[model samples]
Target: MIGFGLRLTLRGGREAAVRLVVTAAAVALGVGLILVTLAGINGVDAQNARYAWLNSGVTDATSPTAEPSPDPLWGMLGADIHDGARITRVDVAATGPRSPVPPGIPRLPGPGQYYASPALGALLDSVPAAELGARYPGRRVGTIGAAALPSPDSMIIIVGRTAEELARTPGAAKITSIATRSPGDCTGCRFGLNADVLGLILAVTSAALLFPMLIFIGTATRLSAARREQRFAAMRLVGATPRQVSVVSAVESTVAAAAGTVAGFGLFLLLRIPLADVPFTGEPFAPGDLSLTPVDVLLVAVGVPLAAAVAARIALRRVRISPLGVSRRITPRPPRAYRLIPLVLGVGELAYFVGRRPDTTNGQILAYISGILLMMAGLLIAGPWLTMAGSRIMARRARRPVTLIAARRLADDPRAGFRAVSGLVLALFVTSTAVGVMTTMIAERGVPDAGPAARGTLMVDLSRGEAERGAPEASGAPVPDRVLAGLRSAPGVRGVTVIHTNPLGTMVPVGRWHMEAGLVACEQFAGMPGFGRCAPGAVAASVPPHFGAFDTSASSAWSRTVWPAAAISAERLRDLPAQGVLVRTDGSRQAIERTRTALAAAFPDPRWPPTTVAEAGADAENARILAGFQQLAGVVTVVSLCIAGCSLAVSVVAGLNDRKRAFSLLRLAGVELGTLRRVVVLESTVPLLIAAVVAAGSGFLAARLFLEAQLQYALRPPGAGYYVMVGAGLAVSLGVIASTLPLLRRVTGPETARNE
Candidate 1:
């Protein structure tokens, strides 16, 4: 009996060609998407592993600050990020743990001994001998390992020394931390041996995206189920046992699914080849990192076929197939209120998330992830129910015969109708959620939140050593006196507030004790706690507990803050105890440029970087990150749309011959050609429109809940552009469904009715 069933399955392939092709395609697409996601993650981790020492970690040899920098990773290289990495001073330091030295670079034996990379050693060699020792204070012992080098052109240097001799060295430590860590590698996967927020996020996003495509794939498999049931019933009447019929059904689906799964693997491999060049975290991916393990590939190869066979069995459970009743088989009275259970559960989870927002803890992250998962699951589970309800509502209000037919068909079999639109709904939901997320993200970092300078304020300051390092043998660096003079003469100069550090190393009598202070002079200082800002004549001192070790409190005009001491003019700098001027200009770009030119003329070779408060390109890195995520999301959406189009086309075109009898009967009973066309159109479109509304609503809700659960109350709705995109997508879907309507006229012809 099984052999007979298998024979029938093989012979019937041509008859079920459309179903076979679409089902296989569905499986292939789903499998391919998942594989690609895995490859990307593995690739990123792999790249890190290949250059483990570089990303292994880095240490800062700087002293502790009262307040930490906002994000240290960003300010890692030179202070002037605009120049990328054109630094004159090689920030090399050592005397720590003996990390694996690169092959070319030898280990240093003691303190005051150094092993520099060839690139760095040359730069040090260029410095004058008299100043070199004072600036670097180390003997070049050997070269660094070439393997440890980031690149031949890198401006960085790592000065390694034996820790035994450096422990006793005073003031030898500062803020030191790892550069590139390998925590992502301990388990050879980004997910670790366990789950983490970053990993969970990646998983959730993949699942959210691919599940819609899966629905389309499932629909493809089931597109001709009605006709397949009729054939099986005929076989049952011919003395074939139910078991034999089941075997045939299973064989057909399994083969199609298996074929599609294999195709998916092929697709994944093709995709993997090019993606290796794509950058992640500012580095290209290694090909090996993007490949799946042999075990993983094997599992996918086996699991997808088995799952398809299982789905085939489940699809046959609802209907009682008998030769006589095959044409009039009953569908279970549409999915009921039970279908709403998932939606109910999702709402409850949403409430829970709102009540207790997620924190940095693993439990919170899990809960947050779970909440999102629930929201996604609810939409999937409730799709049929929503479709059913909408159909019933439409059927009751339907005025035309064609509308009534469409309404009733959907009301009776919303599961089928829902399947047709489910993939698109999921895509739309995810896109909308992304919109909300990105909107909030962009809004938060709208403008660079650098210290003190409000809108339209232009600030210029000189570094401490800018005076002594006047550009190599070319006259002298710009003096504060000339800079202030230029600023005063510049056009559109609204106002100028000059603040310079106290050069006299002033001490004010505080009752019994005279407290030493480094003062900044601001004519009108805007107060910064502990580091004062006030009127022009006010002096604000950022009195340190001990300021001798680190005086780089105000390192650059942009990176840190320098405060006012007693307000003094540049003219009084010689008389008043002081440092170079910290000028704040209340003017336009024209005025700032004029001042820059004037300062350049006054000091022949100034080493200072004169910058402004106006922010531009501050969020470039963040924008790139956002764009990458959006690009991924956009691809998912497009794929979902293609799958949706395929699903709709299959539903409309696949079973025309089988549906001919029913379509003909209606025509014989006085149904006009236009009426039948309307029926076809309504059957496809109502469910589509209904699914769209529900998907959009669910997506918005999820995003809103995400914001609240994460406790980020900032709300930014997806703009009209998002809606336009969704609308355009739906229009295309509608157009595709409509294109298939012409087939109804051919199938419902007088000739078809007479023959049947």
Candidate 2:
């Protein structure tokens, strides 16, 4: 029976051949997309594994120890900023002869030497010593291996320091061995998105892509349904049992599906290198990182064909029950109104969670994901009912032959019409939600706006005590006069204001508030505008304390407080060491770089690099992460829409083929080609527009609720990009449908009608 099925499928002439080819192509695309998604997920896991050791801070001892006998290594981890990019700094010192080595390096470097990642080594070679290299203050021994780096672009430096030097650094811990396990729920972990969040995002993305591909494959298999029904019914009349007929249908679908699956895997291999270049997490994946396991390959290879066969078998139920019924074109039962329940339930669930407002991060994410999944499933289920309702309205309001013909056809089989555009509906919903949340986040968390006057100013922390809490008290020495002289002589120097903090913890009365005092030289303070002017004849002035530029809480605390510039004598100022320095410059990039270079030269410690007000206000790292996600969302949306477009075109062609006899009768009765084209347009457009509006609205609502519930953010409109994404998707889909219009004349021609 299977051999007979193969013979029938292969020898069924051009139409059957076309159907087989289309089915195979659709399955191949589906398979390829799935494989690509799997690769991405695997790549993220691999990266997390490589980066695990970096976050494994001090497993041997929780705190710095004065009397450590057994531990071989003492390590301290910190971060440095260079031209808005973060560099991970690991300061390690060997306390014993047999120290455990970290991944990618041969051994811990001896004193005054360091190992840099390949990217960091290249960066060090490209730039001047003062700007970045002086910060490391060591000889570059070699490059860190790929096994130790998260990505090729990662910037990491493992500096070798003395045991005494590491003991004086804050956050240093005695390490006996390197940890191989992942850092679970470590808030201070260096990697972007923890494992939980990354897994969640990949799962959502896979679901969004996979569902559309499945729909496309199903649509592909059911092409030319009326013709297939006739062929199967004829076999029923020729003494073929219904079981035998189903086997033939399944066999035919499986062959194309199996061939396509293999082709798709080949396509994935071809695209693997290009896929690795997509920086979905601010860093591109290593090509080898994006590989599927043997089990993954086996499942996709086997499952796709099985799914296709099952779909084909289910599609032939009407033929299997009463083949004559299919030949006579009996209408199926209309979809019930209860299909709307899931949509309502899903929306209600989201609303409930939003109003209740979960306290924990995990709880909030779970609720949000559950609501989203339910809504997606609901959209798929309720689509046919909505299509039927719209078609009924169109039928009643029809004032033209195109509208009447389109409406009547859609009313008879709304499910098929809705299914054609269903992929697009889900795509728009997911895209809109993602884009909306991301845009809102970007807007709310935007860089702090210091006035234009603050642009030229660079703030440098001169207090060694500020670097690490556990550092020796002797480290808090006054800045040398030579360093001050160097800054004053640096190119683009306007003036330098030496800032001093109250070491005694004294709270001087400013207005009604007794605020902690920060002292600045009154003469230099007057030259800097926007930061209040000092009183006349005052030698020293009191100002808000200068923490790092990125310290928003401190800035906000003093924003409304009016600080009185209480005069202090120069003799008293001379008693205090300069805690920080404010260097006013020419505001040009060259000037800023030169000033930064001088500061870097002065201070070998990179922990507190010179930063401008703007640099402090802008959260570059978070922005880059969000941008990666935005790119990912955009890619998924485009792919889903393309798949939807293909499904629509195939469904349109199938519709025409199924109703060739009817359309031919209409053509012979003087129906014009333009009217027929308009009919096709109306049918695809009405259901699509309806589904899109519903999907987009639902998506926006979900996004808004999520933001309010999770982040306590106010309602904000999505950016212009959201509109552009949606508009482009609709235009592409309509264009695909229009492209299939020419096939209308071919399918319903007198020659085709006469033969059937």
Q: Which candidate is the best by TM-score?
A: 2
The parts of candidate 1 lying over 4 Å away from their true place are: 1-14, 50-181, 184-195, 277-284, 318-328, 359-361, 446-624, 654-658, 754-756
Candidate 1 lDDT over 1-756, as tens digits, reads: 566655665666665766677788888887887787777666545544434333322332111242333322111111221112222222223434432233345542344665565655675576443322223346767766544443343333444333443333332322233333343434332211121433455566668766766566566666666667777777777887777777777777778888889899999989886766554333344455678888778877887777766766776653344556666767757777877787677767776777587555677767756766676777777888888888889988988777788888888888777766777777777777777776676555433444433223333443343344443211223344555565655665544443334445566433246665434434323422223344344444433212212222232232234332444444554344233333344444444444444433442222233334333224434554455555555665676667667766766665455577788898788878787777777877887888788878877777777787775565687678777888888888888888887877776788986875
Q: Pick the candidate with the highest lDDT.
A: 2
Return the TM-score for each candidate structure.
0.70, 0.90
Worst 10-residue stretch by lDDT in candidate 2? Answer: 60-69
Tens digit per residue, CA lDDT, model 2, 1-756: 999989878898887888888889888887888788778778888887787778655342222343333756888777776666778888899888777678999988988899999989998999877667877776999889999998888899999999998887666877776755554444556553466677678778877877777777777777888888888998899889998988899888988898889899999999999988887877888889889999889989998788777766776667888768776767778999999898888888888876688788688777888888888899999999999999999999999878998999899999988988888888888877887787788677755555544556778766554544654333455667887788888888787777776654556554356667678777767656545566666677777555344434234343344445555676667557667777878787667767877776766555666777667656767767777787888787778778878888888788778877888878988999888889889999999999999999988888887888777786578767678878988998888888888888887888776887
lDDT of 2 at 386: 96
Structure candidate 2, residue pairs in collision: none
Instruction: Output the lDDT of residue 82, model 1.
Output: 19
Q: What is the lDDT of residue 81 in candidate 1?
A: 15
